[model samples]
Target: MNVKLKLPFVGEFGGTWAPQRAEAEAAWELYVELATRITYVELRPGEGLVREALTSVYSLFGTTRDILRRYGPAVSPADRAGELTFGTLALTVLNLSLRPMLARWHPRLLAWEDRRPDDVSKMDHENAWDQIGELRAKLEEARLGLVQLADVLAKVAGAAPLVVDPRLLSNPEKERGGG
Candidate 1:
């Protein structure tokens, strides 16, 4: 079935995402998370690192993994035939970009916690850590990968490139449609 989508500033566009458009729309939601919520921070060694920051990265891994598993198979044969399609790009990001970073860091972070001294608080241990820079670099790489994936997905879906306004992030109410 042909699905018509009305996008802001882009006019009307149509695409058939096989069984239903909802699957494609569901996959596109990851673009929102990658564009808005996932931010890059300098996680330098010997600098204080908040638990929440690392937690967010872990969440990123989970979110991306879940999306890949859910939507990777939904890619249409037409999209898969192309050399540079959303499905291929998403798989590349998940397997080549994110998986390695997660594979290395997840265990390392756990080990660091395991080695934490009895008297030292988790916060204090994190503050005294000296391996944060590597993690930061990996995160930055993943961020770039995710952004690239989002851009490709946008093109595939005929959506405008995401240009997040700082105001919208701060005041969600301002973005709500007024009655």
Candidate 2:
């Protein structure tokens, strides 16, 4: 029997945020360690760890969002001038750092869900796997968005102006694009 394995999204873009990558890797390791312990519980065993991991992930996300919000706008005037503001770098690092944690947690969460008892008799295992696949796809998209934002931030880091239209920043569409 051939068993299909699901893989997490891994990016090749490096150096633009190396420190962030290290931090993110460490965070992901911790998350995995904690998650493994939690998942072993025969009956909701890792509830506390799960909550803690969720809280950490949410906090990281919030920090990233705040940094992006603060630095997304504002153009740099010249090549010598620094366009990549501290806020923008912070956002990039945080986003990059969270990649591993997000990747691991997503799979664990899906596995847990898979083990869960199906209330509706009509619900099928294949359907559950499909749902997990969908969730994984969404996660990948989110990660890609962060990477793209980081790429833009890297360009700004190289003396690009931080000038963004203030009105655009306020707009939901621009906000989604990291302005």
Off by over 4 Å in 2: 1-47, 71-85, 117-179
Per-residue alpha-carbon lDDT of candidate 1 for residues 74-163, written as tens digits (9 for 90 to 100): 643454454433454445555555556667777787788888989998877765667766666556555554554556456545578676
- lDDT for 138 (candidate 1): 59
- Backbone clashes in model 1, listed as residue pairs: none
Cα RMSD of all models vs. native, in order, equals 9.9, 18.6
Each model's lDDT comes to 0.56, 0.40
With candidate 1 superimposed using the best TM-score fit, by how many Å does residue 31's alpha carbon deviate from the native? 0.4
